[model samples]
Target: DQLSKQQSEGDSVIKKLKEELAGEKQRTHQLEDDKMNIIKELTVQKEKLTHSEQALSDLQLTKQKLEDKVEDLVDQLSKSEKNNFDIQKENHELREHIRQNEEELSTVRSELTQSQTQGSSRNVKDDLLKERETQVQNLKQNLSEVEQLNEHLEQVAFDLRTENEELLEAYEEVRNQLEESVAGNKQISLEKTAMLEWEKAPLETELCRAEKRVLEEERKYEQTVQELSSACSPDTSALQLEQERLIQLNQEKDFEIAELKKSIEQMDTDHKRTKETLSSSLEEQKQLTQLINEKEICIVKLKEKSSELQKELDKCAQTLRKNETLRQTIEEKDRSLGSMKEENNHLQEELERLREQQSRVVPAPEPRTLDSTTELESELSQLHRIKGHLEEEIKHHQKMIEDQNQSKLQLLQSLQEQKKELDEFKYQHEQMSISHTRLFLEKDEEIKNL
Candidate 1:
């Protein structure tokens, strides 16, 4: 009976050992299933991390492009500000020029007012008219005097000419008389020479005969003296009578020589008187000619004075015409100045509009990064529903990426439109400034011409 009891206990122990082995096998299978699920979850996390990294890289590139666009816009804004400053400077210069023109216009208006006031006064006008009338009358009187003087000088010259002709005739007559007297004196001298020759021959013959007679008388007187000494008295009275006849003949010849000397002295006095009369007539003709020359010079000076007065009258007329033109130009300038003020107001409004537009432009936002710890916690909690949750998350991430891309594109379009508007505004502003400068230059040229 003890042997049978030991066999039963061995059987029970073997059965218990088999049951424990089966339990161990089932626990090993459960552990292996858990290990596989954890590995799959880990792989899904790695794929999500790679997608997120790609999205981050795309966001970085988009941010860099946005920063470059912002820098470009900033540079454009600075350039526009510089352009505005230059335009303002030009506008200031234009205003200064306008102010100077206005000052000039004011002065001109004052002068015009003074002239109008003077025109209204009857006393001033009458005085001016009287002065002009007096000047005209004086010029007329001067002209008449010059004409009368010229006539008087002509009459005097005529009388002098007539007197000169008469003197010339008298001189010719004296010259002819002198020539005739000289011819007569020459004939008389020739006749006297022939007569002297004839008288000399007879006197020499008579003298020779007288000397022979005297010699014969002397011999006869000696004979008579001898005869008287021998016998005296009767022939002495006859010799005395012969001596008295010879003395009477010598006295008659002396009377004829005295009469010839008196005729020669009378001829010399007549020739000297004729010469003095001819010289006095020539001196009178020279004096008359000098007087005529002085009268002609006085007439020429009077004519020159009349011409100078005429030139002064012409200058006064030209000045009056210039004053009329100046008044018309001042009126036109006032109208132009009014129009320029209106244009200046319009430009200031446009500048204000541009400043407001520049202030309205929007800026870019900051970028974000992935949070790894939060993603790991979320993955663990959704482990059983991982596939479904991953599908929904991927769709949501794609929608967010699409929305970000759309927003970036819209910003680019807006920037492009604003850049186009700015360029067009700059072109219009430049054209307006050019036209304003051209108008100002034209006004300046007109003023200079005036």
Candidate 2:
């Protein structure tokens, strides 16, 4: 009956473990799906990031070209200003020359008039008239030169006006291009943010659902464990002690699992924050180094946790092997108990035959029969005592086997749990490294561009 009860309990435990395994598998599948979805989103983000970077490069090139154009226009404007100054100076010199010639011509005319009024000799009058005529001819030449200078200056002024108009048009076009580029950059930023938000929403919901499911499973498992502990008999105090320790370990493992989940969530948040910072304006990009440092710290922590989980897995494996050996030992002990029971049955049958033979015997052998019966009774009592001791030992061994099995199961469960956590940690670590590399490259490129 004890064996039957033990088998039933083992079956119940196995069923529970199987149920937990199925649940773990389901959660693993869910995690895989979430991972795939996240990967898809990351891929999309990468494409968009590439596109944005390309667009940014193009915009930067455009801005550079426009800047160069503006600088050239400024140089041209400075040169035009200098040329205007030189032209003005030349015009001033020309005006002064014309004025001096006019004064000379007027003086010459006065002298000629004075000579004519004084009635000087005809030679003197002729000479003065000739000089005045010469002066007038020189004046006419100067006037003609001045008129040509004026026409040249007017042409230069017209050319300057036309060039200024062209420069203004170019400047306006450049300004319009700049405005369009700024608007386009703003639009791209908005689209990027919206896309990120859209992607983040679904992941958050899935994480929430997964957490809820895990919590529900944990509660059920705890309730079942409590029921089993309460149902256990006082004779199994050792088993109970073992169970309590297993429960504590399980609780610790659960806590660790919860911590891992929180860490995963934190990692997601960090990733999102980093991405947002990347998508922010150029000024905010300067903080990327610090963020990368923080991410590195997170990676280090994750590595530590992974190492711890690995150690735990190793320990569980060792314990599982030990439990396997214990199970074999228990089975051997059970066989010994079975053989001893068979011997006891044979002894009981021999005693029964001896009794029947005595009943069939005559009065001539009564004394010998009485002595044989007494000896047989003593031997039977001794056998019964041996059988009782063997039964107790078997019961003790069975309990040990049950405890070993329970521990084995717990170890297996912990192994599975640790394996899952390790996988997730490794995956997240790879993702972080990938993102870090990409971000580092991006920052380098941005710095180079700057």
Candidate 3:
């Protein structure tokens, strides 16, 4: 008996050890599976790290390119600033020259006015000279007339003396008339001489004033001419120097522009490389995320497996307890079987009756219930009709959407055509504007010639 018990105990221990070994083996398999998953995840991470490193390299290159571009831009800016300073200086000089020219122009205008005044004075002097010569000729003609009148008077007096023997009274009257006429002629000559002298004096004074004005104007004109000559003189050397400077500045600007263009090209290349790198990095990140998700799923499965293993262990323990209870019942079965048979038959009958009662208690399908069924059928028909209506409405909506899409497509096509037309119109307008400008220039030239 002792040996049997010992053997049984040893068997139990062996069974427990077997169960433990099985559990441990399952645990080891689970661990191996987890390890494989971890390895896969680590491999994915390594690939991602490699991708990131490549991306980082690309970013560093891009950063370097950007720094170079910034430096080039800064250099260009400095050059531009210098060019601006030079241009400002040139503008200042041009303004100063313009101011000087304006001052000179005002002086020239004053001289022109003075010259006009001098010409008027010279004309006045010439008129005075002509007037003086005409006055002298008139005086000579009057003297000759006086001489002829005197001769005629002497002849008449001699004739009257001979006739006085016959008519002394008539002769005396004629002699008195002749004497009065001679006196009147002398008075007129004296008045004419006095008037000529008075006119000559004022004319001489005016001539002197006009001559003085003419001399002053001549001097002013000479000064103006000298000033104009000086002002009109071109600073050819300075202009040439400025032109050369401008050319130099243009060359510098071109060089700067070239540098900027190179920098921009480099920047574009860097940006493209960076974009490629970023895309690769994103793909790697996506892969890493997928791996992480897979790992999470594996972990969940492992946990479920562990729980299932625990449940199996618990079921085995429950089955062992049930076996122990069944063994005890088997030992008691011989004493109770005969009495249990009668009770079992009675219980069977009761169980059947209970089953029948349960069946009766349950609701049964009835033909009169067909009224609710018909109502439900009507509701179903209504729902079907509603569904059909909705389907028809959906079809109508689909047709409307299709029509809208077609209209939108047509509108887009029209817009494209309109854009093309606009481009053509713009080109035509540009051409017209150019032609107009040319025509205007030609017209201007013609007007200048006319």
Candidate 4:
């Protein structure tokens, strides 16, 4: 009964151990599955990390390109602004020049009007002088006709006086003879002599009046001639003074015209130069606008690349977290496996002590020896079965451990690949930064020159 109780107790302990081993095997299988999952997650994380690094590199390259483009745009914009300022200055100068030219033109028009007025006045004066000369010639001809008429009148008067004297001598000789006959016809002869004397007296009075009027007219005409001659003598001097004045005015007008022409020519040259400069400035502005557009495109592309890199980085972080959890589960499984191994070693030591005590207490009788042998045989058979079960459980745990190890190795390899990719991306980013800085410096120098 005691042996039977010991056997039953050992069988119960073996059953408990088997149950524990089964539970530990299940745990180890779960751990192995977790480890495999972890390795897969780690692999996914490494791939994601590699992709993120590539994306980061692309983002950095895009950023650098955008920076360079921005710098170029800034330089172009600055140059365009300077050109605009210069054009504005030129426009202001042109406006000033135009205003001055308009003023000069107005002054020239006024001078021309004055010159035309002076010329018209001089022509009118010349016409008046010509009419006066014609009047003087007509008056001289009338004075000569009056002198001829006075000469004829004086000759007639002399002839009439001689005839009258002869008649008077005849009358004296005939006077004595006439005394004898006078008594008969004296009244009739006296009447005839009275009639003749009356006619002669009236004629003589008319001639004296005509001569007096002619002398008065001659004196008045002579005075008028002397005054006209004096007036005519100064006309030449007056005309010369007028001509000198006109010549001086013409010279002044010519100088002013020359100066105005010179100014106009200079203004035209300046205007042409300004137009050319404005055209060049417009071309530069167009180029600057084009550069700005290109910069904007580069910036958009850079932003897109940055977003993609961030997404990849996020996915890699998620996968890394999953890998960490899996690694912890694998560690727990390994600890459980070690504990089970220690329990198995303790059970083996207890079995060995029990076997040594049984060997020392052997009986000398046949019946007793036979009973002891049979009990020992049964105990040995049970021990062998428990050992076989323990060995099978250990083999299963060992297989799980090997699988975990392989999973761990795969995870490490993936991690190494990800790290190498990250290093490459970092190196590329540093190089880009250096190049971008150099380009920025050059752009700054260009701006200073501008």
Best by lDDT: 2
> Candidate 1: deviation at residue 398, Å?
99
- Candidates in order have lDDT scores of 0.38, 0.50, 0.40, 0.41
Higher-TM-score candidate of 3 and 4: 4
Per-candidate RMSD, Å: 79.8, 67.8, 77.2, 81.5
- In angstroms, how far off is 440's CA in candidate 2? 12
Q: Which residue pairs clash within candidate 2?
A: none
Off by over 4 Å in 1: 1-113, 118-123, 220-450
Alpha-carbon runs more than 4 Å astray in model 3: 102-450
| Candidate numbers, best TM-score first, in rank order | 2, 4, 1, 3
Candidate 3 per-residue lDDT over residues 234-263, each given as its tens digit: 644643453364346435434544553454
Q: How well is each residue in 246-314 modelled by candidate 2, as lDDT tens digits?
A: 567457546745764774676566556645555654333334344445545644554564455445445
lDDT of 4 by residue, 69-162 (tens): 4344335434434443443454345346434544543454344345333423223323323432342343234323323432332343233233
Q: How accurate is candidate 1 locally (lDDT)?
A: 0.38
Best by TM-score: 2
lDDT of residue 353 for candidate 4: 49
The whole-model C-alpha lDDT of candidate 3 against the native structure comes to 0.40
lDDT of 1 by residue, 68-175 (tens): 554565454355344434434543453464345445434443443454334322233234334433433543343344334334423433443343344334434433
Going through the candidates in order, what is the number of backbone clashes in each?
0, 0, 0, 0
Q: Give the per-residue Cα lDDT of candidate 2 at 321.
A: 52
TM accuracy, model 1:
0.26
| TM-score of each model, in listed order | 0.26, 0.44, 0.23, 0.28
Q: Is candidate 1 or 3 superior in TM-score?
A: 1
